[model samples]
Target: MLIRDLPEDVVMEILSRLPVESLMRFKCVNKAWYFLIRNPDFIAKHLFWATSEKRHRGLLLNREHEITRTPWVSLHSNETLEVSRYVDLLQFFPRDVGELVVFGPCNGILCLFGVPADRNGPRDGLVLWNPATRESKALPIIQRPAEMPTTFPFRFGFGLDPKTGDLKVIRILNLNFRRCQVEVYNLSTDSWRVINTSVNPIYRINSPRFPSYLNGVHYWLACERGGPDHWLMLSFDMSNEVFQEIALPSLTERPSFEAVAVINDSVALILAYNDLATRFYYICVMNESGEEKTWTLMFTIGPLLHFTRLIELRDDGFVLLRNKNGWLVLYDPITQEQRELPIYGDSFQVVSYTETLVMLNGSGECA
Candidate 1:
């Protein structure tokens, strides 16, 4: 009747249901447990349970010098938001790496990028980190094209291929005003390859905003190269390694601001319209992924005094918003209530993440 005497399947079922923090500690109990926990099949099953049961539904706040994790709870209710834990970047990375910019939490792996303080030093700014496991892998150095401009803009996105179970990191570098260079890094191969693709001249990926990964695709809000006159949704399929453009709903007046986030397993677009006379924000959700006509306005809030950005639309029906001051605020679309979260930090970035033991190499085995 002892636990170790149980069948392997039964042990796996029990272990998979445990939290990641507990599972990490349990791995040290015995060599058998260690191997079992590190098995690729076991890791997948554990992640399946973790996501399906909503075991680790929380907010990953990227601060100036640290990354803080907190539970996303109802603001109107008695539930309180507290920092469950955090990781200091300086402890794991050198300060001379410049400012750390986080890319994604695709399957619990965060893609980080930073510029080296010394231009002559190493340029391998890409780092893949798993907060739960505290394990990280540095990607190979990226070669700067000789034709690159002095101040070119670049953005990074992370995604997982469901069909092949591969983790891919995509970097879109704007070579010039009209040209873009695309590069994709495959975790399974541990190599970076340039994608020979041409982007439309009228549309450009907005580098200031992060891309949303859902259903094996990464989505970004693309606008007219220099102005906000036109907007479109750009999607990249990780499995096929292809890009597709989806037209957005036409607006009476071009939106002054726009952002995209994943809401309720669908793509949601937050549009803000401002003029000298009035200003308003609209929350539009597309029930279907690629269907442009499905874009319906869910709710409209405000003619506020300040400009606000949409951080996320939580599962509990609350929207995480950030104001001009960079403070975290929770807005309930149903109740139409707004309140500030107690997390005090400058330059806030939030991402909806589920805790998992997914390794950076796309294999459960330790690298």
Candidate 2:
């Protein structure tokens, strides 16, 4: 029998096993195949199989320099952490936009915030990009409040609302260390709505660090002032559009650097103390979500000499690290082994990446 004559279920099964690049080209063969590949149900099935099979493992490295570039480094082995290839991202963006800040990669779509090279150029500053399919959509410009201070730093969080299957972007305008304005943009509506919820007065977030998204929620490391340094985990639920705080484990001394990340489907905290004096590092994993008592010390590595930043935690007992010299190194906490990856770049921002066929047109609809 011919390929086209195959049953719908069989066709979908075969298509799901193929890479996204192949499927994108296959869609052009015929309208029947185009609609079939673009179907929401098929996309979900492909994603499920891709994740469970671990087929799309890679590293997205953002190289910051005169001409910013994003290169996707494919990971082949967890033990060796070998780089398979470096995929250039220049084709995914426009010519005029140079500097782009990537937000989240929830469900394969990366939300990007960029400014035009020319200050007064006409362009959509915000964009949604799907690297697997090479599809991108520039979102409309957001209007700020009249009274909002010009110098107020803006923080953004991107995630998908599992309840409604809507892609939402949460923007927080920090007017000061204590108070701020919050807004949410719904992809389906193509508009931004000002959320009346105010951030907790006791906690203040570090805007320079990006928020981590896991299971339809965004997490940020926040600190409380006045007495001793108190760090807390701040979370925003995209499904319900609400905010909550989770307390961190007690610390004798404030960590010089701290960030929140997801490890093995649970929230994990990476803390580094006094880089100048101490070579000790700490990794704390939460046994249960939203529970302060469940936080447990996972690992403590000592004499790590310049390994200062934790880029990501791998499933096979290894953690990706960035030393003070700014090189990417793979360190095994269990075996006490360390090796530097052969990725050459001036500056690198690494993020966990998985390739998918998720559409960026609107919500989950195909363009």
Candidate 3:
């Protein structure tokens, strides 16, 4: 049946369920769908559902003998359940791209940033891609300063303004030691505007691990340096376009291992340390300081989670990655449990959880 035969609301509902690929393809099916799909509200609705569906979905990249392949896989909700391996897509990536790969997924779109070859060479920028739909938009290149420190690392986040519904890309450049520079690009303006600001001691590029989206802002872990070497918790607010150091709750002693992530719809910091009797773990629930009250300690899981990779799952929960019988296993942190996801054929390094996708090592060629 023609889409026109369906009610307007029904048509939008149907469009929202289809992956981005089907939506883009359906746009060519008729003029009405083309106009409907392009509507900002419809795009927002599709992005909402896509992000929800992607949260539970897991992507695996298997590379062997110099050949790499990445396939999107989904995890069953059951903690101990096993699901069959499936390939959502089977395609080879172009070769000689870059050494470092970072996945910044916003809405249903995944933006890839690559590490630059040298100071004079083209720096890493944004490329929009939809895995579920396999449709992509290669963004224009943005200027990068060549004089920055060579060894320093940078962080990137893709966000949308919930107020004006504008799509933007934010890049935080951390120089050698602890210097930071913030730059924002709006798709509507197609220009890069550097924010005037100075990071206190300097923030280091923490692992791409705990960065997440909530209430239209992207939050990640950064060290706010005070003295020559001391570091504190730093947060980058994407919506209001500001950066501020957070004061963590008072603890007897700071944990040796610290991670920042979003949990239960709130920004949280997980501090872990080893004590003589048992391993100590503490979670600090975050809320705007003056807007509300104080930092609350949620839970404390013992030494069992010493070396686990803690990540916020796509399903609004969390997962712990550990080696099980030489295979990687995922455990849910909240329930204090574990499960095995059958990931095989490791040719290239695969870094992904749910919202953050994976990009294999390759030469610079559009896939």
Candidate 4:
């Protein structure tokens, strides 16, 4: 059948089934395809299809950085695989020597902002990267006219601002030494502008963790305008560049670790705390009131459960990197299952994950 003979909606349906990686590369096929893929409606449709198809996708795990053994392993079948076997989808950085620390992944893109390699430059930097396609674009620097206070705690967020057709990076800089200021970067104009908020709030670090992106707004937990210790949640509207606060469920005391996760397609907070004896977790679904309903107790690690690190995996569950009998076991709380993913590196650190992508620090052993 000729290309023009196909119905427009049917053609779009076929295109939407293709993975984002393939669609991105096919943009070069023609000007029409390029414009179609770049359209906001098409992007939303593509994301919906991708998420719907991935609800039951099998897990692919890798054993990274093995000196005497292979570099990758898959968890789905309880088998070890070679990293070189999937080089097309897997990219490795043997070492990362930059200050652009990454905090979270959003819509398959990772948010990163520049830090000094060695404190040589006058300004900090920012960028958003898509590792699957190896595509990244650096953000323009947003500067404050005066020197920022020493106690300033800053958080960065990136998303598309639909109103202006510009991708924006919102920076929340909390200045305890002085009043804090809100700054934003517009990718289209490559400029930073300071925005004024109605009531200045003291940023809260111990409250709920912020989601990467939601409804063109980035949310953060902050101190209420009433007092220093009183906690509140703040949302930055990317398009309007305005700040608004959301109310959350009333708790007797704040949680130690920020409870944040993507639950049921919505950003939910995983409220958790641990005393010396035991660990307790509450999975709370967030609503417009900032209140959490449907409170569910997820897990409790007894006093004897000694884990060195806990990382939330791409599968909506988390892995506990802990030692059991001198062997590292990756524990899944959801399934109450554990597998020995032997560690072989001297100082092991996880860089990131893409699908089943795993990259170890040095030498690691896996079963």
> Best lDDT goes to which candidate?
1
Taking all chains together, the TM-score of candidate 1 against the true structure is 0.86
Q: Provide the clashing-pair count of each candidate structure.
A: 0, 0, 12, 14
List model 4 lDDT by residue over 287-355, tens digit each. 544333343344443232434333332344544344534345566666667776644432222323232
Q: Candidate 4: which stretches are off by over 4 Å?
A: 1-9, 24-44, 55-98, 142-146, 149-153, 162-166, 199-201, 204-210, 223-229, 252-255, 289-307, 313-330, 342-367
What's the TM-score of every candidate structure?
0.86, 0.83, 0.71, 0.66
The weakest ten consecutive residues by lDDT in model 2 span: 70-79
Ranking by lDDT: 1, 2, 3, 4
| Candidate 3 local lDDT, 1-367, one digit each (tens) | 8767889999899777665435657768878887777676786676567556653343433223223333233322333334424323213122223343435445544555544434456554556554544455556675556766545556666766777656677777765555567888776666678897666535564655544556777766665455423445555566678766655566667565466666646777777777664455567777675744367777665455344433333333545444423345555556767666564333223324332211111221125
Error in Å for residue 72 of model 2: 11
Q: Candidate order by TM-score, highest to lowest?
A: 1, 2, 3, 4
Scored against the true structure, residue 288 in model 4 reaches a CA lDDT of 46
Candidate achieving the largest TM-score? 1
Q: Which lDDT tens digits does candidate 2 get at residues 1-367?
A: 9987889899999999887768888988999888888888998988988777867655555545423443333323333456545544344445455455677778778776764455455443677777666577767676555665543446788899999989899887765555667889888888888887858655567642433788898988878766346677778999888988777887777675468877666677877765666576787887764453467888876557754666667655677777777677778887878888765455555555567887867444443
Question: Judged by TM-score relative to the true structure, which candidate is superior, 3 or 4?
Answer: 3
